[model samples]
Target: MHMDIEKLVESGSIVNELDYERAMVADRKLRLLAKTNTHFKHLRNKLRNLIVEYEKRVWSNEDAVDAELLAQSDRAQLIIEKERMFLEKRKKIIQARLKDFSLTQAELGLLLGHKSKTHMSELINGIKPFTLQDLVIISKIFKLDIDSLVPKYLSIEKIDRISAVIEEINNPKLSKIKPTLLSAS
Candidate 1:
């Protein structure tokens, strides 16, 4: 995704490709991950059951344990770990972009109606998650949707999660409820 964006920026500021089409690769990759992860989980559960039952049957036979099974379990565990690492890397990329356009911590605090830069930095650094209001404010300030601003290689699942969070924040019921609470208090 970064490569595409870099190419676009280098060529000119316009994205000649449609976003949905551009997102297709990410979507496919995410779908593959979903399928593989699901299979890995299912296999892991089966492996655990096998190990437990094997232990019951061959408690004294150390050599009876299947090394191949253990190897497969390790591979599955490694895959899951790699997926998690990839997600973290994607998050970092999004964070860096946020910082690139962000005001200083003090400036962000003022914009977000906070009294402390420490809290604001936490949000920007992903040490603390942003509230919906903060996400909205950041999106507007950057002229970007959280999804679009995020790294292109990021899984569509993560993008959808971010979009869902933003949508929930903008929901009319929550928006209305907040004002009512302020009025009542």
Candidate 2:
């Protein structure tokens, strides 16, 4: 297994084979995308189940009106929204990867066995949801091991900066408490 991974990473350097280089990079990109998709799918399912449970409660008793249930529903909605945004981001990354390889989106779509450029574009744009099987197909085309992709895709140190900014933005009280008294309002 380790040998296969090394082979993939070293594919770019194989003698007289530029295609190997392309394959290696594509493999890396596809693996990253598949990992991201898996994360999104798992989160989506969890949110879906929570929403279902909440709906069941509401349906069972019209007068129940659990404030906590309502709050959970709101949280579920936010999670879905955030996941949608994340999907879009992932699509953009995929598109960018195609661009980096100087491949037309249509060409990439073809490579991925997608005939319709529009549909392919939608996939690349994260406007369409892909089955896990589709992600596997993508990895096959790239010749990558799906298991090796997750850690690299999920480890993002910069997320802390973004989270800190969002935390400040969401807290009105914190916003009201100016960091510096001398700063103009």
- Candidate with top TM-score is 2
- List the candidate 2 regions with Cα displacement exceeding 4 Å: 1-69, 140-185
Quality of model 2 by C-alpha lDDT: 0.45
Tens digits of per-residue lDDT, candidate 2, 7-121, equal: 3333323221122222333343344444656633443344334434434545458677678656544543433344444555556655666666787878867776788865574
Candidate 1 lDDT over 63-91, as tens digits, reads 76577645544433433343334446645
Q: What's each prediction's TM-score? A: 0.31, 0.38
Q: After superposition, how far is residue 141 of candidate 2 from its true place, in Å?
A: 5.0
Clashes of 1: 0
CA deviation > 4 Å runs, candidate 1? 1-102, 148-185
List the global CA lDDT of all models: 0.44, 0.45
